[model samples]
Target: MYKQLLITGGAGFIGSNFVAHWLAQHPHTQVTILDLLTYAGNMANLQSVADNPNLSFVRGDIGDKALVSSLFAEKDFDCVVHFAAESHVDRSIEEPDIFLKTNVLGTHNLLECAKQHWLYPGAKPRTHLFHHVSTDEVFGSLQPGESPFTEENNYKPNSPYSASKAASDHLVRAYHNTYQLNTSICHCCNAFGPHQHTEKLIPKTIHAILSNKTIPVYGDGLQIRDWMYVHHTVEAIERIITKGEKGEAYNVGYNQEKTNMTLIGETCSLMDKLFADNTQLQRQFPEATKAAEGKSKELISHVEDRLGHDRRYAINANKLSAHLNFSQTGSFEENLLDTIRWFIQQHTKVSTIDI
Candidate 1:
């Protein structure tokens, strides 16, 4: 076990969850979180573990070479779980330069720092690990009814976000091959869970429905995505970092493929259920009445399709299962229902955010 672990981008939804999960599993381990706290990196996501004795937080950009190097030198982290990047595809379309800098250059800086600190001459074997968290977007879109993406899939990134991630993945591989740095990579499918920013599809839909705003469905809402629960992905990352083979890339997914339309409909149905229950409560107690039990589905609004939007994305998790003894714990339907309940509970909190 590593004495000191550094998790970059630890304030974001996935990173924050990973931190909370890691600390709970390893009480003796010390963790340092470095995050830039961009729009998506919410501090509230980490409030649950804020008071934990084993965790520490740092606010800074990953592209800052001096800051990253200083942290590596000072802390001498034995493992790095890198989750920081400009992740939203829509945002990347609007701003590609920011993606290149933060995702590509920022990763390069961290790799160099790790090389200098952990790859010194005669270093202990497998004493350090630099685990990069990436996405399946790097493989671009799959044809209709095609097989899922695997490690051997060719890189055909269509968006700036994915291209930047591909570049970082290459750099990580290069460092491992040339300098013998212990590195691993896991490309995951779309993730949804609590603490996710409103920019994402599920959260955005929830926010729109709750506030009586239009739920924008890009194009025909036929684009397919393999949705994985956030906790499941985090668990895969933990397993890979601890037990995966260095220099290997693993694909983590829930194998739960759903089109945008199907997902939106499911979300609307759950919201309706919650609203009906609330209405019943109001009837029982007249003073408890708040707002009318309005139908959330009325908010659906079709919008122009995004540029270069992939038609589908799927992942084959055979390697992850074979090597790490891992598999998804729940079906997409089960997880989606749980997610809907969570959103219903958080309606007030999400309503305040600008959709």
Candidate 2:
């Protein structure tokens, strides 16, 4: 379908990747991106698709009803993939009002606009979709060895971030029930890949190691999380938007669970190998001696833990797999290695550009 899709927060990690993936796969589709370009939203991440004729980027807040309405009127977006939000749990703890405004109110604005524009008495097709991207944190931390979160899991959001997302999810469901707006909610696990902002755990650890800075581990670092590559998450979202039932929710994950310490150690080991190989090569060339020569793991530094941090977040993606016949590439380890290599390459490129 050559549809006009509006992707909010398209400059953010997964959103940017989704936009790129969708454009590449569906060459006929056109995408308009609305992002406020917050701290986590990096325009540089979308540089690869910046010049694509099928893509348009607009910097604006989702809370701006007039702006959103104008876009709806002008672009006549057939489908909306809503990813804009304040996503960090720690940051949400510090400033919840921002989360409420962006995540809850922002979603409300989008729903209202869509309802007004696409839900008229005699609207065409009468099935425009508003896909809400969410997190598995809404289900709270699971007990040790318990089954993963499923579509039927109760909402037990603990942090400001999850609460905001839960509120948004409720709004989407309410719109579907009350106004008959077509919507689907997708709750995904922790995502890691290229162009991810450095504030997240994996990217932060990689950046710290590359810069020879201390890697901070919270608590005993035993917190478990289900990890999925960004590309896989994008694929899940596309599948949901195209094939999902209205007012339904799906969990997208790799089913690869690992503790924080284990994740950090794996990243450190990868960095160690890359740095060691480079250091040995430097020995043959005196000019390369200035390059950093040491194990990146020496930078490990444990710090205070986050308050009310979820101990574990697992997802049961049976609904996604059985219904949509969706299956991930099953390359978590390989994908992680490739991600580390990308981070190292990006660090080197940034350093070169800075000099």
Best by TM-score: 2
What is the alpha-carbon lDDT of model 1 when measured against the actual structure?
A: 0.87
lDDT of each: 0.87, 0.87
Q: Candidate 1: where is the Cα deviation over 4 Å? A: 122-126, 280-294, 349-355
Clash counts for the predictions, in order: 0, 0
User: Worst lDDT window (10 residues) for model 2?
Assistant: 282-291
lDDT of 2 by residue, 122-233 (tens): 8776558999999999999898989999989999999999999999999999999998898899999999999898889999997776555788999999999999999899
**Quality of model 2 by C-alpha lDDT:** 0.87
lDDT (Cα, 0-100) at 267 in candidate 1: 85
